[model samples]
Target chain A: MWAITRLLAGKDLRVEMRSRVIINQVVPFAALMMVMFAFALDSDTVLARVAPGLVWLAAMFSLLVIVQRSFALEAADGALDALRVAGANAGGIFLGKALALAAQLAVLEVILLGAALVLYNSHIVGSGIALLVGTYFTATAGLAFVGTLYGGLAVGAKGRETLLPLLMLPVVAPVLIGATRATEAALGTNGATATDGWPWVGLLTLFAVVFGVGGTLSFGSLIDE
Target chain B: MNPLINMDTRATSTRFTSALGLATLIGLGWLAVFGLFLSPNDRVQKTGVRILYIHVPSAWLAYLAFVVTGLASAGYLWKRTRSLTLDRIAGASAEVGVLFMGITLVSGSLWGKISWGTYWTWDSRLTTTAFLFVTYIGYLAVRDLGGSHEQRARRSGVLALLALVEVPLVHFSVRWWRPLHQQESVAKGKLSDLMLFTLFVGLVSFTLLYVWLVMHRQRVAALDDMVDDGGLDRALADRRSEGMP
Candidate 1:
């Protein structure tokens, strides 16, 4: 299982490294989201106050793109069939794809954090940065697990590009709420507590476990022709 | 006449449905009369509280519909008794669920405007209901993706179950996030007897209305399946005559 997961993750990482689509396309899109938010709000104080949420919104939008690409990559040349015929375990395949997506999102989110700090004239200093990282990991895990599952389900379905986000965004509301509130607490805004972030962390973790395991066990059924 | 197309059964069922629809109409009419005229207004809420009769029952029916959808989906997924009927029931219930969810949101918005002084709020119940609305709308959309009956049934049954899991999670998450909505006490000691009676009338009538809608929709689905199967059979026969294996 470990070997298959690594092999699949390595395959995706190699494709991402060569293409740099995440760098050239998605990162800039996330950055543009910050710039647009700043322009729309048109107040430095308000922008600063809302930067945490803006960062999360950017991550989620980028997530839609990444998950779409993940499934699309397989569906293109029947690579999904190729993987199945290669005797890859469904659970390993799910975990590998989720890990690969999470890795890409982690990089995108780190860049967005910098963009949020610089573009919104906000700063994160202290042990609070650790909380921010924690929130990012858990939130991304939940999103990747869920997004990958739904992406696979939506693949080959009609109008999947439009369908995936409609299916995904509402389901991930708790993550958005948790991640935003956690980020706000980390930034010492909204009179929020570091303790306030824990339940959100727990929720994100639960989402990750439920969807992650559920997606793994169900992937075989989803991929059945 | 074909047994499946028996005029007597069809006519009787249609008549029964109309009779049930009329009763529902009368039940709802009396509910409005009771809610609007007979039930006394709250000292604090006054007439604005009238929205509660519609809003609460709609939310209740939405939850009830989704729960039925979940159970029907479970039946569809289980191999022992797997049937198209289960799938059809699930889809029908989800459709009714989405309709009621929409009503819940719209009425809640109006209620909030009258009482909370805003058209919307991030209040926990409101937020969760909105999520429920969108999720089932997605469910209904996925049903239209047009696969083989088995594939569509399997995929949608899985999605229905997954979405069901979110109902409780959304409820808890929102409750923890913001305790803004009023606590659930309508069935408790909160309301006066007349108000409680009116509310019960609303609940019972709306539930019957949901059953009527689901049954009618399920029959429509069955007819649709018959038509779809006939089309496929004709297509296959045409292909066979053309020597296309």
Candidate 2:
């Protein structure tokens, strides 16, 4: 199971690396969103105040793109059917795809964080670094697991492009809420202490674990037909 | 023709369904009288509190409907209990649930404007309920994504299960995010007995209405599946006949 997971994850990563879609298209898109937010809000104070939310919102929108790309890759070439015929463990396939998505999202988030700091002039408290990192890790994992799960559901369906976000965004509300609040606390904005961030991180972790285990168990049945 | 397939063309009525519909109609009539004219208004909210009769029941029935959807979806997913009937029930309940949830949101917003001086709030319950509504709408969209009945059931069943699990997490996360500055109570204080009775009537009527709607909607969905299957069967038969000649 672990071997299949690694092999699949590596294959997805290699495809992503060679294609450079994330670097060329998605990163610039995320940055453009941050800049757009700055223009829309039109205030340094307001932008800094809401920077945490804006950052997560941008990450989430980028998540939609990356997830769509991930599943589209499999479906375009009937790779999913091939994997099933190859008799690879379904759970491993789910985890592998989620793992690759998480890795891509992690890099995107780092750039998003940097973009937020530079564009919005947002400042992170020194002592809250650990909390900030924790928020990114747990929230990214939750988003990746859920995105993969729903992506699989929508993969072969009609109008999947529109359907995936509709299906995924509402379900990811917890991650958005938890991540935004946690990021706000970590950045010491909205008068939230670093201590306030931990609970939100816990919520993100819970979301990740529930979807991770559930998605693994059910992915086979979902993609079977 | 398959007897089961042939049966789909018949009207989806029975003695029990007729009885249920009649009870729902009578209950709704009684509820309207009690809720609108008979119940006393609160000292604080006055007439604004009247909307709660519709709003509360709609919200309650919506939750109940989604729960039914989840259970039916689960039944379809489980191999031992799998059936298209369960899938139809799931889809029907979700559609009704969305209707009621829309009523809940619109009425709640109107009520909020009357009382809170705003049509919207970042309140946890409101936000979480909105999330729930959207999730199920997506479920319904997946149902319409063009597939065989079993394909629809399998995909949507997984989605229903996942969405159900996310509800609590969405609720608590939103709750903790804001920490609810207002008391968030249904009423300012304890309700008068008459008011309570009216609310009870509302709940009962709305629940009966939900059952009636689901029963009819499930039948409609079954007929829909039959038509789809019938079309495919006919097409196959035509192709086979051409080859035979």
- State candidate 1's TM-score: 0.91
Docking class of 2: high
**Pairs of residues at least 3 apart in sequence or in different chains that clash in candidate 1:** none
Q: Could you estimate the TM-score for every candidate?
A: 0.91, 0.94
Q: Which regions of candidate 1 are displaced past 4 Å?
A: A85-87, A191-193, B1-23, B185-188, B235-245
> In angstroms, how far off is A30's CA in candidate 2?
0.9
- The candidate maximizing TM-score is 2
DockQ of each: 0.67, 0.87
Listed per model, the TM-scores of chain A against the true chain A are 0.96, 0.98
With candidate 1 superimposed using the best TM-score fit, by how many Å does residue A153's alpha carbon deviate from the native? 1.1
Model 1 lDDT tens row, A24-121: 98888888888888889999889888888998898999999998888888889888878889888878888888899999999999999899888887
